[model samples]
Target: MLKKLGQFTLSILVVSLYSNITSFANNKPLTEAEFKATKLPYSVMAYSNKYAHEYGLDASKAIKLPKGLEAIKLTLSKSFSKGYGPYASKWDYNCTAELYVDKSLNLYWPGDHAKVDKVDDRGLQKSQISTAQLEKKGKYWVPGPYASMLYDAYDKTVKADLASVKLSFFGCGYIPSRYTAAKDGLAIWLEKKGGYNYAVIGQGEREISSKDFYVFKLPQNLVNSYLPYARMAAN
Candidate 1:
C-alpha cells in the first residue's frame, strides 16, 4: 500500500511539472499595451525582426540605424495614403513612420495583426507629414552584389513550412574576399518532425545548396551589423 501511494504522488508531481512547462511554451507575444509601457522606439524594426525569425529569413546582422530615429503612428489623408503602400487598406491602419527626429522619415503601414505585440494606435493623430517630406531624408542600407545574389538564391531555392520552423540565430561572420564582396556565413534552425535540424550557409561562394549547409560560428555583433543589408536583400 505504501509503495503504491508513493508512486501515485510522484506521477502527480510529474504531471504538474509538465503542465507548467507547456504553459510557458505557449505564452502569447506581448500585448500592445505591454509593449507601449516599455516606451521603446522602432516598433516596425521590432516587428520586422520578429517576422524575419518567424519565416526563417535571416535578420541576424547588426544594424547601424540612423540616430534619433523613432516610429510614430499617424493618420494620413486617404488620397495621399492610398499612394503610399499596401500596409494599409482603410485609414484605420495608420502609417507607422520610421522618423529620424526632425530629419528624414520612411513610412510603413503594417496590417492589423499582432506581431511581437508592437501595436499601432488606430486613433493616431492626423499627419503633418507632407508627401514631399516622406523620402527626402530617408536612407536605407543596400546589399552589395554578392549579398543580393545570395538573397536571390535563398528565396528561389529555399522552401519550408514556415509555421512549423523555429527561429535560430547562431550568429554569422564575414571574411574579406579578393574577387567579390566579403565572404559571409550564417546558421539557421528549422523544425522537423519530433525535433529541430541545423542548416548553414557556408561562405558566399556559389549559390546556397542544401547539401553544403553546415554550422559556422562568428561574433554575434558581426552578424548584427550585417543583418540590415541581409534583410534588405531578402525584401
Candidate 2:
C-alpha cells in the first residue's frame, strides 16, 4: 500500500510539472518592470512604449482603445459555413482599429471570421463558393488582405522614406486558428528602404511566415486592451 501511494504521488508530481511547462511554453506577457529590464533597442522600446501608452495598458487588465480610430469590419468568404460547429465558428467582427498616418496602423481583434456562411433549405450551412471551403481545409485562412493592406498603406504613406512602423494586433487563437490557446500579441512591421523587419510582442519570438518576420516575446499584460474581443469569442 505504501508503494502504491508513492507511485500515485509521483504521477501527480509529473502532471503538475507538465502543466507548468506547458503554461510557460504558451508565452505569457512580461510585466512593465520586466520589459524595462530587458533594455531593448531604442526604436523597439520606443514603439512598444507608444503602443502601451496609446492603448492604456494597466497591469494587463482591461484596455481602453483610442477614441475616433476608424473601425474596419472584416468579412469571411462564403466557404466556411459548413463543417464548422456553431460554437467553433461564431466570432466578433467589429473591434478593428485603423489610422491613416504617414503609414497606417490597422489592428484586428480576435474572433474575426475568415469565411462566410449561408443556410440551405434543409437547414444545413454551406459556403457560397467551393474554393472557400478548400482554402480553409488547407489551413490557408490567415488574413492575407489585412496583411496586404498593412504593406500597401505603409508603402503609400512612407514614400521615399528609409523606414516606417506599422502595427497589427491579434488576440489569442484568432490568427492561425489551429493554436486556439495562443497568447494575445501585436506585430510591428518595419518597412525599410531595401528590406522589411517584423517584431511581435506579448508572445514568444518566432518567424510567422517566410517573409522577414521576427517575434519579440513580451508579457501579455502589455496587450490586454485587445484581448477581450478574442476572449469573448472563445467563451
The prediction achieving the highest lDDT against the true structure is 2
- C-alpha lDDT (0 to 100) for residue 146 of candidate 1: 18
Best by TM-score: 2
By TM-score, how accurate is candidate 2?
Answer: 0.25
Candidate 2 segments exceeding 4 Å error: 1-192, 196-219, 231-235
Q: Which residue pairs overlap in candidate 2's backbone? A: 29-218, 29-219, 29-220, 30-218, 30-219, 76-115, 77-116, 78-127, 78-128
Which residue pairs in model 1 clash with each other?
61-223, 61-224, 61-227, 62-223, 62-224, 62-225
lDDT of 2 at 112: 31
Clashes of each: 6, 9
- Candidate 2 per-residue lDDT over residues 1-235, each given as its tens digit: 3222111101000111111111222344445454334321111011122233333422232222222121111111112323354456543322222222222323221123221122122110100000111112233221121122122112122232111222322322343322333343442222222222233344323222312222122223322322332333333
Question: What lDDT score belongs to each candidate, Candidate 1 first?
Answer: 0.21, 0.23
Instruction: Report the Cα lDDT for candidate 2.
Output: 0.23
Task: For residue 40, give model 2's deviation from the true position in Å.
Answer: 33
